[model samples]
Target: MAVHRSRRWSFGGLALLVSAGLASAVLINTSDAATNRANAATVTTTTTFSDDFDGAAGSAPDSAKWSLETGGSGNGNHELEYYTNSTSNAALDGKGDLVVTARKNTDSGLQCWYGTCQYTSARLNTAKTFTQKYGHFESRIKVPKGQGVWPAFWMLGDDLGSVGWPGSGEIDVMENVGYEPGTVHGTIHGPGYSGAGGLGAAYTLPNGTSFADDFHTFAVDWSPSAITWSVDGQTYETRTPADAGSNKWVFDHPFDIILNFAVGGDWPGNPDSSTSFPQTMTVDYVHVTTSDSGSTSGSTGGSTGGTTRTGAIKGIGGMCVDVAGGSSDDGTPIQLHNCTGNDAQKWTLGSDGTVRALGKCLDVKAASHDDGAVVQLYTCNGTSAQQWTYTSAKDLTNTGADKCLDAKDNSSADGTRLQIWTCSGNANQKWTVG
Candidate 1:
């Protein structure tokens, strides 16, 4: 599992690695990717939470805003680093930075739950400390780079323990792999779109500028209906219900913030000969604001200039998808009715993981992915059942079940119910959206 390139790694136990030819040990060069992105956003001064990390070097992070999460249970990604609460792994640098370091564990007798420890890092969260439903969440940081390095600033639902991952929802504000020193990613994950399949996009520095060379702000402006992702204030992506296809949207609840640095896992794979030890991800600040000063109107709009894709989800028999009777009810049967070019068939796919119609979303009932699980029109909540991916093959598959959105019995009738079924490459399971 010694991959050497840039690619996403899921939290489950699978691995995929590719090498994009990163210059080894390149001296840090300055860039304005962060400054430009930041100047593009209008974050309000009304603060709901903030930490400048002004503590003296060697001290722990503020206990009121962050709790150190320890252990190395692979975090469900089959990661290779032991997470620790030790000051050596995470502590404020005298220079006003929260340094989360990944190092080669030197204690010979020390072992992880699985085997002898080789690496150690840190994970910090605001689990029971501070959870919020919406607003602006931002952080300024300089990330480290090297093969197998995985650094992220993200959030999870406060009910994570009870609901578990995808059901609890995950929002990745910023994540950078060491092999891709010039790029960073932001994504949202639920039961369906967790791991590498989570809906997201990468922001690459212009002219091959390395993001690891300088500090930049990563952020998301979240509302009841949509989420807008940005880098340094430059809005690059926005997601809504329609973007999730037939998956459920499950992000309306409160969530906790998390920051972690991982090494040698599924996506980035294991570090090899060129990899270095004792890497650090430095954070200068973390802030949250409840202000609406930077929001866009309507159920799907944002100021960050993120991509907004709108089209029709045309399925079998050349019919367009629709909400039966164009109703707004929760269980309105999704059908393959005639294309009337009305709002009932209008779908807006967004950077956020949602597929929206009539301002509602296409969702899998109860988040089920069974062969016959029903699809319906429902209010968006950022759940997995509502997450959709329009693959190159034109198949509409649910992230949760990995099943194709199918026409019941291959029927072309106006009121045929849509369901998830085994993807057999049949006409009934293929779809087209522009």
Candidate 2:
């Protein structure tokens, strides 16, 4: 099982999630941050592979770039669905889309690897004819509605047969649980950091717009050392080897891409009374580009910029805001620890007033303004507690509270708790970047 990590999610550009107690469409206003990010993600160049789903109605996925992964053994998620290669489960619609449907399992006598098959869906992968080390990968997809529908576009290391799981690595470009249709998840799983402990982020749409209402583009700009995830064209998150604490960086190798719609798993749980069957994941297109020209990624800029925004945020004691135990949970103490060039210690300052790492905002607990409110990682909600400013003097301040981020007791030790205190102009309250 993938261990669940505490995470950060932002409502920056959420216009609406159209729903009547269920996720539907999302309104993307031009002024929304998510919209801007989505638009920013679409700038592109030369392509290595592009599929518009223009195949004849009911045709299978291109045999050259994709193959079916079939089974019902839950694939380790204890899911209730049976993955099959049947055309009925995955076929091209006459309307320029590839529709992968999940229906009630009619094969009463068919046995799953673990239990009885209760549902049936399709799983496709680009393993045999397609594998790449780094580049941009994007897809235009419309996820299914109703609870229990788990749609995803992801990738796995091509060396899965040789190294297995965490060693092979997994990059989830996009995954949407039916219940949270307005939200999308991007994650990376690798040695010592697979499953729920995966480094991840979430992008949610505004209210009144259901993702199921229309198609949206989800993409990732991947390079040798980093990967940036985006929705539409808006880049929201990026992960790199530095984020991998003591874990092995397993993403430098080639990987095979995958697309699937699962039902009833540990994350989404099982279907309920209101859950609808016959869910479908519609795909308008899939494209891969090799051009790094004009690419936008958190790791896109020059490394030697000497800016604190791209590297460690060192404090008066030369300590940094380190991830506790290399854990990626939200609320992980942003303490002053010995600086290490890992994702846990990386901090990026955004024009949006956020100091972020691992796709989460550095937040003050509860927006409190008390004498000793501690700072922690939280979902970036654009809240006052999240609004911050790193000054020229190198002090990290909560602009909303006007308090300097302080390392408790002037401590420079590992595991020291961090808090907000009135500026004292002391070295203990000072900080530096890069």
TM-score of each model, paired residue for residue: 0.59, 0.59
Per-residue error (Å), model 1, residue 148: 0.7
Whose lDDT is greatest here? 1
Candidate 1 C-alpha lDDT tens digits along 86-182:
9999999988899999999887665664687789998887764666666567788999888989899887765555665566677788888878889
Model 1 Cα shift for residue 184 (angstroms): 0.9
Task: Locate the minimum summed-lDDT window of 10 residues in model 1.
Answer: 17-26
lDDT of 2: 0.68
Q: lDDT per model, in order? A: 0.69, 0.68
